[model samples]
Target: MSPSSSHSPSPLNPSTHPWRFTWETLAHIPTLRLYLFRSPTPTALSGASASASLQTDRSLLFVSLTYQSGDVVRLEVPVPRVLIEPDEEVQCVVRSDHVEIKLSLVLPVDHPVVIQYRAAMGFSGDENSVPISLNDDLKSLSSGDVNLYCKSCSTKLTKEPLRHILQMPSLNWRDVAENWFGNCCCSFGAAAEPGFSFEILSGPMYKSAVPNVDSCNCHDNAEGPEEVAHTSDMHDLNHTTSNCIVSNDPDRSNRQNLYFGGGFVHNDTNISKDVEWVEFCCEKCSSPLGSYPYWKDRGNTGTIDGGVRLFKCYISTSTPVGGSDDVFRNYTVQNLFSNLLLESAEDEVSFRTVVRDLKSRKPMLQLVLLSSKAWYMSGTCIENHATGPDCQVELQPVVKVLFSDCSNSSEADIRLVENWSTKCHAEEVYMMTYEIEELKNSLSFGKQSMPLSCNLLQGMHLSWLNSHGF
Candidate 1:
């Protein structure tokens, strides 16, 4: 998509302004990075709360958004209640574009975050202010005597005026944006395509053959009930054999595959010595976000360390070096990793299957084997064949069908507009048509019998897939 769609505002100046009077001041605050963000459940290991895991030694204040054009304006009030909602998204207006930015509500907002509402989106006229008397009710911002309420909702938010962590000067969003354009050579080559842009918050940072979070699948059924009981007893005999096989947190599967999906930039300077992984934070907000595996940990395939480059998410956050009239277009992990994802399909495990196990407190690796396949299908039926003048044929599925099988005996059916587009780019219109299969392997927690099945069925567009060497 053209970065300069009507959805995004045009370059503003004395005339082509997306916003004029109220938000014109924001053109001065510089570019603020808005990571494609969404909230998810925290892992038990991280004390699993809804918060960013930033670990900065220096007193830095920021996470990854850089500016390329225009300016930013600091709202005197605390971070508005509107930006904090998962359902409600906020955008930052830079140059001519108004792109969506993330709000890290779970992370402690130490001070006031700039209200770019007027900037990202234009004002709704004079109807936006509070009913309270501005002259009499207004109090000092620094003394903690005043409270800020959301323009959308009246709830009191914070006491800080400007975010405390970083008082650093905001950059010209256009400058950085342009730098990225040249860095990427061209926008498409950089893999920045329009889609839902989000930052990777958790799960494995780097890819490896032998992952620290290893999960296994049980593919065979025990011979009999007595045998099942015996096997269960034998398996229960040691945590090393069973518990580790099942691993923990089935939710991690979804985290690894679906949302926050991005690959690591090799030869990273920020990588930690820890074998399994290292961490990354927003260079702008100081919020700990991404991570990558050490070269040694990834076995033979990884390079040690260098300038870390993130490819799956939006590749360019800065403006072009020589400011191009073009606005920086938003990109997504799906578009960035499209080729690799199609090649990586398997029926090993699906989120729908694991979630059922989560509710039942069952291990996905107990005794199951999974295999999956997907494709586009069409079926034709003539509606009024007998009446030749009124004969017509129609396809039943308006969208594509994602049919999967889990636990051999169990199956799942899903519906979607397209395969490649389903990954965060569009809504999932799905239905679990089949009843979940009861575990035949699960004779008892002490025993095992059935090899469960997981059929991963989402496939790429045949036309696109074929061209990509699928």
Candidate 2:
């Protein structure tokens, strides 16, 4: 239920709410912060003409403010899950101007040392939030007998269901493992060069050899018998190496291939041998799907040989048997970013990060995680009354963060980012241009709902990025 006040309208009548407020609590923080905003009236009371009362009983915290005009605004917050020490004093600060009335409160510590404020405020996790994981989503998609399509145009992208799905190893898996174990496990062994090896050699063995021809043609007037023999040996070695590389390539194997990892999906099928590179797009709509490598470099994580790497964001899935078509549940831009940030926090063991544009490599936003688990309830306060009193406003789970916009970064901003990168080891997160815009919108909306005092940390804006969604 929304916070209650004596003269405030019911939660069902949100349109007449007279106050704008935000109540927030972070994990492990023993204090609860509540900010209330009300427009100042012509006859508003102040000084000796105004007074406020704060008290806690059982599982509820009650607040009341009385004006000289004999009007009273009261708010009640339910804290059933958090034990409040009613004996302790509560700190309430009120600031008023011709424009608005601002009220702030800091509650004392409860019995539990650490707690999620949302839980205390009577919000159940199951009803309010859904956590999505990238790996889990891919696995679920692979298991379903569905056809993939372009999200924008609904053009069929796959001729058939993906049969074999594999996850690509992390780009810096070895380095991370070594740091933890103090030695490389050698899981993939010393075969770092997966498909082929190209070597450059200089000597008399190539002095008489002609360049730019398919075969190494040697001049008869060039060298002695020993030099000629060396040249012959080099040519054979190069030919044998090329043959071995072609045979060892896994993509050439007779397996229906589809692999996903690192926020990308690859499709390998029906490719002609002569087509060395391709820009994958929907044939009917010609919407850009993804691109294929001109040549494969197994050393680079992005280049999967014999396949096109499609961005998951640009594709959709349809399962005819399930009667679900054009479903965009887990694939929304906000959901993807939330999961990525959660995963990155765990993988990098750091809460600070810089979000950059995937194509331009420009810093879009810099984020410092304040709390992985935070809950907040914010809305306008109503004065006009309605009969129904049972309506409730649900709290949302969010990743509380302090962020800075870097699109038009100044010299100070640049230095601040460099400090986080070097001193804090803040990891870098890359996203598409559109995805960045969506994330920025979410952050700004969250910030506006917060109290002015809670909206800034140092020079960065404090905001919330929803951690869970359907």
Candidate 3:
């Protein structure tokens, strides 16, 4: 009857291993199961034309489930296929030997989806797989200008506008003239009276402010006074603008004093004081009628009276009292030489009688030679043909010849003689052939004379006569 002999074990003393639990009690505890599934529909991968299929056995799904037996379990289940459409739904199913369960699966069709596959890993198992779109953004942002702006930053953009200028062909000279002249009055009118209404003068002529009157002169009542005044005013205005005066009117002599005024008079006197005067003499004859004073001597003789009378002198001034010196000097020299040579030659050869007489007549020839040395010393003839022999010469020095009987010699001979004489100074024999040709053409009948043999001064061995077939 004591407790030590009792068959029942005490619950507090687990060492006796007292109570045993039944299977029904263990089955009543909670347990978890996981499952995976795939849709039967087909799906297309990006950049691929064919529909993609899923492997039912190889495709996997991860699940987190708890069992009623107070245990946690993770399961990987195979999915058959994944369906893709504008909108579609897929579901997962979990089952055991006794009961079945279902849950909705979130497909990537709701947003952008990335499907990826990884090989079996370590103890952690394979990672979750997803579908991805490759190079999607690169294709979308390829072209056109892109403007970028920051949401929270202050930035400035600068804009520039282009300008263009164009010229038109319709513009004319009148526009330019008007722009230049403005409102200035034209030349030629009655002189403006004091207190006359005026405006500022504007034009190329007027440098300073001036009255808008027509002219400074107050000439009255001539013929067409207004026109004449206008013309005169234009002339004066032109003169003032050019800083000089030029006139050709016969009346200019009388009006010279008025035009020149006291300022010009003073200038003229001042200029005259600086000038030196020297007298020129006739290279042939020393005469006073042709003699005049000059500031400078050109050391040459001039012709006068159609070469019949030799004027040995000319006036000179250092100041520019006339036009260009070259023009005047050249004209004087040419006139003097041509007239003196022709006259002196005519006198010596009796050319006037030869021209007047037709029949052959004897000529009294008198040759007067003028040497370059004569200009430095007294211009006396060094060689005189009148005192020399009467025989015809082949070549002679330059001389002024006078013949008392020119009728016997033909004009051809006279021309030949002149050319031969002139060209001989330079030793040019080619001119002799030309003169012979001229003589043959002028004479009624005669054979051409051959040219003289001559040598070049610089190249003495070279003969121009032989080369020219002269």
Candidate 2 residues 83-115, lDDT tens each? Answer: 444454566655431112222223322223222
Shift in Å, residue 21, candidate 1: 38
The TM-score values for the models, in the order shown, are 0.19, 0.53, 0.12
lDDT comparing candidate 3 with the true structure: 0.20
- The lDDT ranking, best first, is 2, 1, 3
Instruction: Pick the winner on TM-score between candidates 1 and 2.
Output: 2
True-vs-predicted CA distance for residue 76, candidate 3, Å: 99
Model 3, position 308, has a per-residue lDDT of 12
Q: Quantify all predictions' global Cα lDDT against the true fold.
A: 0.21, 0.46, 0.20
Q: RMSD for each model, in Å, please?
A: 29.2, 14.9, 56.7
Clashing pairs in 2: 5-74, 16-382, 17-381, 17-382, 18-381, 18-382, 19-381
Higher-ranked by TM-score: 1 or 3: 1
Model 3 misplacement above 4 A:
1-313, 317-470
Tens digit per residue, CA lDDT, model 3, 44-109: 111211111222344433333343433333333332222222122223322321112222233321
**What TM-score, to 2 decimals, does candidate 3 have?**
0.12
